[model samples]
Target: MRNARRVILCLGLALAASEPLATLATPAEAFAAQPQVYVVRPGDTLWGIAAHFLKNPWDWPLLWRRNPAIHNPNLIYPGDRIVLRYDAAGVPQLQVIQLRPKMTVSPIPSYHTGVMLPFLGSPGLIAKRSDYERLPYIAAADDSDTIFSNGNRLYVKQLGNLAPGTLLRVVRAGPQLVRPSDRKPLGHALIDLGTAKVLHDGALAEIEITNAREEITLGDRLVPETPVPEPHFFPSSPAHPIQGHIVGSLSNFPEMMVGQVVVVDQGSDAGLVPGNVLQIDGPESVTRDAVTGEHLTLPGRDVGSLMLFRVLPEVSFAVITVAKRGIRVGDALRSPPPEAPKVLGIAP
Candidate 1:
């Protein structure tokens, strides 16, 4: 009896190992076996629609194979057709071959001056001092250390080789400014002091400086500005733009300002990148009930826009160039709306 039981147990184990186990059908398998066509609708995002047929929304990018027509990949419009093709092994594939209206990229010119920071590629480089630090680094144009008695004149410890008629900027030094919500420190704002001319050069240089707008004082650090290439702004597509709140900024360099860094809530998971322009909008107006005195905040109105200059896996840096109103920390952002089509058929 024992020998027979052992033989039966071994046979059961072999059968369990050899036979294909029963499992739940994946969304792709289901979609492939029973294909359904979904028409593109207004206010529908590809990420949303793809989620219906795919277990992971990020896998949507894998659907298109060598299709050049879909350049932006984010702009799928209403009345467009998105087909779901299935493979012989019962796997669904999403193919967005249909073309829609093309979105034009808005062009804007801007200038920037700063040193190119060294890029740390790997952890091994951190131990090597030569890989981490770069000499002759560009510093901010404004640094001073004169004791001011209610005057704009700035005194420096040493003028070095500063010549006459050289341009300079005035900046204040204090504890690094931190973001109120996230406790991340942003670089101090540099007040442009117009230009300066060296009157005397020695251990200290008595330079005649122009106070642009803000007050100048003592103990401000003075440094030379390094000329760098200007930054360009690239607008996003009309269909999909990201929206989020500013979190913090990066301050690894002296001239690098963190205020320019706009930390939105969206990230790589949302398909964001450097050079993508996002339209910034302010908070919605608040509506109050007359009887109970209760107030409701409506969706915020669109105000202005910004162009992302730099991007990270979770954060991005954007410059505010065309803000109708002042942009705050928690402003909303979206893709700029497409231009209205020309009317021709209707009579005037």
Candidate 2:
């Protein structure tokens, strides 16, 4: 018994020397609180949901990283309940409990990780306005070749320090896009023609045309390429009330169909995000009063919905997910299509 007491006294002194002077809890631990449960409402988004719990919306990754519960943290559906709780360590955690599965299969291949495409698109496409200003231009083509096509060599000028094998998109900077309602110029429509691969780099770089959707011509600008965005960009109603019109169609079609990309005048500057879904509608004339000559408007008809794939400052690229009617340029795009009018019924 005496030996055990002496050993315990010595062990206690050793443990005291090893005691930490300061203890700091992790960031998640600092967020300790009672679990706050939220029921996902119509038009709810993972981005908005994360923002609701975390005052700093951008810190959402902290709540989801390494979490075993959410396989795809970016995607969540309405009617799902999310819990914001603290663990035994007092660390905060975000989890989802779905009452029903809410995934819809899309026709287009939205994401890929296994097979490789023969070609990769522009790496520096997601860029600022300044990057577009000094874009390279096709100075000359193969000898006596007035038009550029696939596998043809292009003499490009104004190219910076691009290494060999860099990808670029052949385009024509069409026009300064302006909002019709306010005549506010947003961005220029850089019509995509095709893509090219940098063969050699220099003051005047040599590029080999890889894919030619349209006839690549001299003076055609080779702007940076934008790739397919994240798969988290799902279709959902816009967060803020939005009213705008289709400015242009990527296909240049007067009337567009489902599964096509179109440009809308509204963008991030107008409260639009990458996942926002806009309602497409068209209005018809109800009738003209015979005596007064006043015009009456028909309730706007819902044509389709556009899911944004990319968002710029004042312009966005959207895909017509569901085309109930023909989508056309100048058609109205609303956040949530106005509800259908209804009347009370009387029973005899």
Question: Which numbered prediction scores highest in lDDT against the true structure?
Answer: 2
Query: Please, what are the lDDT tens digits per residue for candidate 1 over residues 1-348?
Result: 011110000000000000001122543444344334556565443333544433322223434434455445444445545554444553444444343335332211221222111111101011122322321111222445433322234445555666766644443332333444455444432223233445555565665555333344444444454333334322343236555654333332332222243445454556876445566677778889889889987887766555554454544555553545556666767765544211111111
lDDT of each: 0.41, 0.59
Q: Report residue 338 deviation for candidate 2 (angstroms).
A: 8.0
Indicate the worst ten consecutive residues by lDDT in candidate 2. Answer: 6-15
- RMSD per candidate (Å) reads 20.0, 17.6
Misplaced by over 4 Å in model 2 are 1-134, 226-230, 283-287, 290-294, 337-348
**Residue 38 CA error for candidate 2 (Å)?**
27
For model 1, where is the 10-residue window of minimal lDDT? 6-15
What tens-digit string does per-residue lDDT give for candidate 2 at 1-348? 011110000000000000011122333442333135668665444444533453322233434445455455565555566664444554444456654334442212221211111112332122334546677889986698788788999899998878899888887655556677998766666667788989898888899999887778988888666565335533345666899988777665678886677778988888888667777888655888789989877777877767676677778777665577789887888876433211111111
Best by TM-score: 2
TM-score, cand. 1: 0.38
